[model samples]
Target: MTELVALVPAHDEQDGIVATLAGLYRQSLRPDRIVVVADNCADLTAEIAERCGAEVFVTSGNRDKKAGALNQAVPAVLDTLPDDALLLVQDADTVLNPGFVRCAVDALDEDEGVGAVGGIFFGEEGGGLLGLLQRMEYERYALEIHRKGNEAVVLTGTGTVFRARVLREVRAARRAGRIGGGDGYYSLASLTEDDEITKAVKTLGHRTVSPDGCWLVTEVMPTLPKLWHQRMRWQRGALENLRDYGLTRVTLPYFGQQIMLGLGAVALGLFAVFTVIVLVTVGWQGFSLFWTAITLIFVLERTLTVRGAGRRAVLLALPLVPELLYDVFRQLVFARSLVDLVLRRQEHWVAT
Candidate 1:
């Protein structure tokens, strides 16, 4: 049988870390080992991890944040495991399905070409409109990922499983001067290491996927501002990773997604401006018709995405869907992400 180890990178997550660890402990198919790297945290993260039966590694200096913590912990983990073990990288605040570890490892073992796989995450059982909006956004993203098929790169690091052997091979290949053809080669260097790893695996003729069966539950942002910040960070990281891989590489396939989304944003902005103009020039009836059409289109979109999520998500998100789609919340986040990345913003590790 193959071995499996779970790696969780955490910092200052005292409030929620205990619950996350407890969830891990309750998994039906327990991992052979669970390592929590508490990165320069001033809280009880290490203690909490230990109490939950996870081996704790407290890092003294965490300059590069999460990526750095992973780089530091990987070798230590490898030292204690067999060469063919599976390694999972997840956030400290994430809760997994009881069968998460078993299903993920089973999938990897069943297919030699399956390099990585991640599961779906639902927002905490119930909150109000804010929680529902968060759930809707995540559900939409997950559906798109599944619909895009295995040819696309859509793996999320939040709860991804990887074959340690494949990662070992990539490292070995890089060391032996087999890939990249030079000394400055990066076995892994993208801002999102998970993306880089999945891309590399694909480039090497392997595949990564997100299965529909496995599921995890995570808490959503309690407020709009927090949700905006979280998504902005996510989008910016994705774009930066995409750029690092060379914009030209993504231009052919991803160009459509980019253009369509950009155009959609512009079209919506125009609608907002035109609605005001028509109200000034014509009357309230014209503005009402325009908004009615917009509202209908949004309702249809949310309806389609909410089929399996439950009625609460549908209703809570229904009222906020218009604001979510037309509002500048995500746009502001995306723009801020760019500034943060460019300014090399000083980011401290915080629990998601």
Candidate 2:
């Protein structure tokens, strides 16, 4: 029989630890074992996890952040499990729907080609308007994956389940210089460990997906500065990972995505310049009825995609200006990351 095991990598997440653990306990198909890997915590996170009846594996002098913590914990935990056993590597701050584990595990069991099953995550509540916007963004992403027949561009870190054997193969491939440098299940050098590992799995001829019913709610940055940093890290890490791997069968789509991002940024910049020119030289003309109708159609499409997010999402989408501004914010983030890549700027990893 295939056993289910969970490894939660946490760092000073005392407040949210209870909710995360509770989510696991509420699972329809609970893990046979739950271990929390507390990495450099001064808070009561470890004690809380232990008190909640979860086994704790406290990290020792580990400074490599989340990836390093996982590199240490995954091997130690995998050592105790059968190669066929399934491993759930989830963030300490995330909470899954009751059926998430069952859904993900079933995805793996039903398909031999899939190496990993990741969550379709929604934004957790709080953070005011910023949080609401972030939720809308995540909802659109969820809709995209759902519409694509559950194909995933990356195995998200919020929550994911992988076969122990596939993880072993990932580590083995790393050691043999097949995918991801250094010998570990995750790449410490890459800022986005999840994205790098996704590439590694697909490179080894295994597919990854975000199956339906595998839902999770993850943290969103409360402020613009924090959100900027988080998105910058994501975008920069993606750019760096693609650079490291170069153009190949596994990375072509990724490259195309980066290209689209660049083009979109350029287009936005051109639009801003055109608006300025029109305002100064051509003078202010009344809004075109035709353009207004076209804009409404665009907003309607956006609203339709996020219909699953509830009525508030529809209400928010109806007001086009706010979401358009938010889109510009994202475009700016992408532009900054592209600039960093061009200059070959080195950024030290800071926990987000």
Candidate 3:
């Protein structure tokens, strides 16, 4: 019979290790085996995981970072797993919904075309206003994803389940030069390993998904600096990976998104400057009914988008100023990433 095995790749995650493991135990469809791959840890992460009844694999002199850690661990773990076995990769700081594994397995079993099932993730509680904004942002993001269709655009790093055979196929594709990212299940060359792997799976004619109730809670950056670094890494990695793959059937829509992002940044900047110049150069012409109506409609759309985030999020969204500022921040980050790509800037990564 086939089994589901888990790999929790962690680095210096003592604070969240216990809860992560506990969440696994509480799963409705628990994993048959749990292995915590403690990568370059200088804390009690491995010890704590062992006490939680998980087999630990400590990385030896792993300088390639998270991708390297998983590269070393995935093959070793796959060797012991049967060809039909399932592999679940969950982050050290995420806790899944009780029915997450059950939902994912059902999804995979229902369709042979689907190669992986990823978690729908929300920000964990705390971090004050920044946390609340992120939660609201995630709500709007999920809404948009579902609006287009409940397709999984990215097999998020928060959590994902894959068939062992698919993993091997991805490795084969990498080796055959069908895809980039070295000759491993995950590419060490990629700053965003999860995203690159998602592309790899799709390139090999396998579909991935994020079904309903396959949800998880993950950490949010607590401060602006932390958020900046996290977003920079995410944006830069995504652009670089897309560059590596080039325009194709799968990456065409993604490249379109990047193009739109660049245009949006330029358009937003010009619009703001023009508005300021108009107000100063001329007198306050007073609000026209047409413009007021359009503005109100835009505000309503923004407010309603985050309704699923709860009453507080709805209220915060109504004002729109906070999220607007946050959006401007994100635009700046995206613009910077584009510039960095053009200049071929030095590589940088911030652990989130």
Candidate 4:
């Protein structure tokens, strides 16, 4: 029976800290201790977390954003933890289902080689059009992770469980200047610390897993602009992580997949431009049957793949208009992210 300690990294999340703590308290296998790291908070986040029965640690002058705050907090928390304990890191804005911890722990226990386990996340219930679209996107994302089985490429920051010993090893490596120079297990060089940690765990000959049974619910960006910034950050961070780690046999396929996606987007853009030019030049008669067939096939595939979301998702995807538009938007974001990465543009963390 390994003890579990939970850490919630929050910044000005006063309104939602209570709910996040409540969810942990309601877990089927509750953690032995729960700590909230209130990083540079101007709001009542620390007060709210303490009122909700969480041990709160307030940080001052932590400029590295979430990773730096975690760096300051993790060492202190681990100093009081037992050898057999596990560490669960979750976002303050997210809530876990009652069985999430239990299932995730079970997955870790089943395999000694498994270093970490992450949950499948879905959008929180209720929202407008943007939220609905996010819900659909999350469903598809979760389905893909499930399909990948235990070889999950990234351990999401939304909700992840890590072995206590592995975390200590990562921290020791950081302190020794073997990996990135930091005081904690997380790295500050990349925008996506979770992904960097995942790579580190793998380099240590450990595997990362995502159990389908462990479901986490989180708030989605309520508008397109917000979503865009969030995704741009993610994409740019992924590029940075890969750049830092360089290409390995394990990461080569992941790199190739992203490259293919980008190439596909380029092809789509070219096709769109050609279609517009043809339409202006020779009316609709210039349209090729082969091009029309390709477009319809792509739409059909997207629609069919999105059917797992729900009846509402199926309905929303049926017309093919909204989903197509969203795909275009995503492709554009990916292109921009690539260009930024190539040009060495600086990306800062933007809180939603």
Candidate 5:
């Protein structure tokens, strides 16, 4: 039998930690060991993890961030791990499907070269409008990864599994200066360690896997303000990591994916607004053709995304303006992230 360790890095997540650990306890293919690294927790995160049957380790230091927590825990867990064991990394706010562990382990067994595996995350129960939007956006991200087929660059940390040997080899390579950043240390001068580490794994010619069967239930920010913070931090971390790794060459796809999508959508929206302005300024006949075309495109796109999210999501489509407004938020977030990256601004960890 293969041994598996589920490593959860948590800080001040008292409210949701127990539920997440409970979910892990209910997994079909139970892990051999469950370790929770509680970094500078002011709440009951450590106690809850221990109560839920996780072997808890508390870290003390100024480096209380997620990366720092992982750095402390990974080494300890690896010390006692079997040669072919699996290391599953999870966020404290995340819950998993009953079969999540089995699915991940099976995927790793099937693919000899697969270094890591991740699954889709369904949003937490009970959500408001903002929460719903965040869920849709997250689903869109998952779909993109799903459609990409086979190897993915980064595995979502919410629920990711790494082969023990593969991760050990990655650590060795990092210590040898074969990989640039985040070899041994988790918080390596950048705000985003996951992105950097996954890229490094790929650099070593190992594949990151995402199987269809692996599933995890995760939470989205419950409020708008929280959503904004979440996006801002995520975008900033991404941009900062990109800069630190000198990976500008690979940024074209990211730009094309985000910027082009936003620009094209917003451009059509602006064209519609301008056409309406011209019609009111002159006569309806002046810009009728342009207005009709732009309106049709806008409606079609929203309808598609809404319908794609299913019947419940389609109801929210009534307020067509929200989609347009979301684009504005996206632009702001991206712009701020760019500025922060350029200025070398540092961001502290904050829960969304």
Candidate 6:
């Protein structure tokens, strides 16, 4: 039997830690041990985790954030487990469905070349407009991952399972100066360590997959500003990770896709600004049939894409203008992220 252990890196997550632990306890395939790394928590995070029966390791003098905390905690417990043991890294605020672990384990067991498996994340319900929008976004994201099958370019941090030996190999490579070095298995330089590790795993000739049945629910940002900052870090972090690894034949298409999307967003923004200028100066005569057709096509595409979001999503889609506005907002966020990346601006992690 393959031994399984879970590592949760948390910082001031007192309110959700108990529920997270309970969710794991109720898994169809339970792990042998659950370790919670309480990094610089001012609340009852450590206390709650201990009360819930998790082995807690409180981090002191570890200022590298989630990556650093995981680095410190994972090796300590992982050293005791066998090479074939599975290591699961889950977010403090996430709740996995009972089948999640079972599905993830099956995925890893299915292929010797598969190093990691990430879960499809569905946003928790009820937060008003922002929440609904985020839920819709997650639906689309999950759908895409399912359609992509076993090939996952980016492994999400919400919940991911890894083969212990693969992680040990990654750690060895880091120590040998083949990859960037940090405190542990994960690197602290990138804003999104999960993305960085995904690239690393691929470089070692192992595939990272996400199975549709392995899904979890997580909290979504309740406001526009919060969502903006969260996405900004993600976008910039992706860029940094790619830059660090240097583009290869396998990564070229992925990089190209992102560049194309960013360029398209810039084009759309300029067109929108031009259309507004024309409307203000030349009245109704300035309206172009070409732009109208393109707008309708985009609205239809977005509406169809979000159809899985339920009745409320349908109602939200009924107003095509708002959906278009939201797309513009997303485009602007991506654009800003590119600018920040070019300027070499540093973005710190903030729990969302």
lDDT of 1 by residue, 172-254 (tens): 66567544311221223444555555555565656777776566777788876666656755566556555555554433354
TM-score of each: 0.82, 0.97, 0.98, 0.93, 0.87, 0.93
lDDT of each: 0.69, 0.91, 0.89, 0.85, 0.75, 0.86
Residue 325, model 1, lDDT? 62
| Residues 1-352 of candidate 5: C-alpha lDDT, one tens digit per residue | 8889999988898998988888888998888888888989999889888887789988868464787778778888887887698899999889988888998888888888888887677676567777667666656656766778844555777888988887787778778877655566454655566776676666677788777677677887777778778777777777765555554444445545555745765686688799789878886564468867887787766656645456656666556777557767777777777777678677766676
lDDT of 4: 0.85
Winner by TM-score between candidate 5 and candidate 2: 2
Please give the ranking of all candidate structures by TM-score, highest first, separated by commas: 3, 2, 6, 4, 5, 1
Segments in model 3 whose C-alpha atoms lie over 4 Å from true places: none
Q: Give per-residue lDDT, candidate 3, residue 101.
A: 92
What's the best-to-worst order under lDDT? Answer: 2, 3, 6, 4, 5, 1
Q: Point out where model 6 deviates above 4 Å.
A: 181-183, 280-282, 285-297
Count of backbone clashes for each model? 0, 0, 0, 0, 0, 0
Clash pairs for candidate 4: none
lDDT of 5 at 98: 88
lDDT tens digits by residue: candidate 4, 1-352:
7888899999999988988999999999999889999999999999988888899988879999999999888888887777668999999999999999999899988898888898788898766767878888888888788787746667888899999888988888778876673657899888889878988888777888888878889998888888999898888888887887778865686699789878889898898999899889887885579988997787677677767667788788767788768888889888899998899887777887
Compared with the true structure, what per-residue lDDT tens digits does model 2 show for residues 1-352?
A: 6898999999999999999999999999999999999999999999999999999998888888888899889988999889889999999999999999999988988999999999999998888888888998999888888888998788998999999999999999999987765798899879898999999988989999998799899998999988988998899999999998889999999999989988988898899899999999989999999999998899889889878767887888898788989989999988888888899888766666
Top candidate by lDDT: 2
- Cα RMSD, model 6: 2.1
Kindly list the per-residue Cα lDDT of model 3 for residues 1-352, writing each as its tens digit: 5699999999999999999999999998999999999998989999999998999999889988888888899999898887778999999999998999999999999999999998888888899999999998888777766776667888998899999999999998889988888888898888889888888888888888888778899999999999999888888999999999998899888889888988988888999999999989996998899999998898899888888888888888887789888989999999888898899998678776
Q: Which has the higher TM-score value, candidate number 3 or candidate number 6? A: 3
Off by over 4 Å in 1: 125-127, 149-153, 170-191, 247-252, 285-298, 317-327, 335-352
- Give me the displacement of residue 336 in model 1, in angstroms: 5.1
